[model samples]
Target: MDMYIRVKRSKSTYFIRCKPSDKIIGIKQKLEEIIDQPVSDQRFVLPGTGEILEHIKTLADQKVDSDAVVALTLRKDVNEFEEVNIVGPNDFYQSRDADDANW
Candidate 1:
């Protein structure tokens, strides 16, 4: 089945459409297109378990399902990957539920 992952980095979020059989490298490639960072400079992690996603593995192999939250980290000048830094949505957007309250 097709799946979409939410890739987060700092204050930006990328909704990537993918398949279970798609490799982690494919995801990196997608990110590279939008972030202007090479695949070699990109890193992905599961925020919940802090597990690093391997480029050679498929999404199914990593148990990354639809709507999964994957954190993106990029290599810095020192050649070290930065820490996961995802920013939550602003309070105004979370003020009320869409179905229960008016915008």
Candidate 2:
């Protein structure tokens, strides 16, 4: 069955038509394509619990129905930029400390 869902971001709202059996990651990928954001950086907020929707689940598994509103926010790390300390050209790999593993 096809479901129409409303995705609300900061100020923009997107209307998407999907299937109940569709994976959440597929939805995130579509949103990423439309909004120029990466799927890894996207978070879908649940209505009641304020919980994030997991990508492994399908729309039906999440109890998301037709005309459902799915709130979206960027992951915390998405907006955060880590400072990189560049050493010599050949020492780039060694320059990063253990604390900068994420970088």
Strongest candidate by TM-score: 1
lDDT tens digits by residue: candidate 2, 4-103: 8988765467898899999899999989889998988778876556766889999999988889878887756746522222233454355456567655
Report the error of model 2 at residue 37, Å: 0.5
Per-residue C-alpha lDDT of model 1 across residues 51-93, encoded as one tens digit per residue: 9999999999999999999999998866699999988877326
- TM-score of candidate 1 relative to the true fold: 0.84
Clash pairs of candidate 1? Answer: none
Predicted model with the maximum lDDT: 1
Q: Show where candidate 2 strays beyond 4 Å.
A: 78-103
C-alpha local distance difference test of each model: 0.92, 0.77
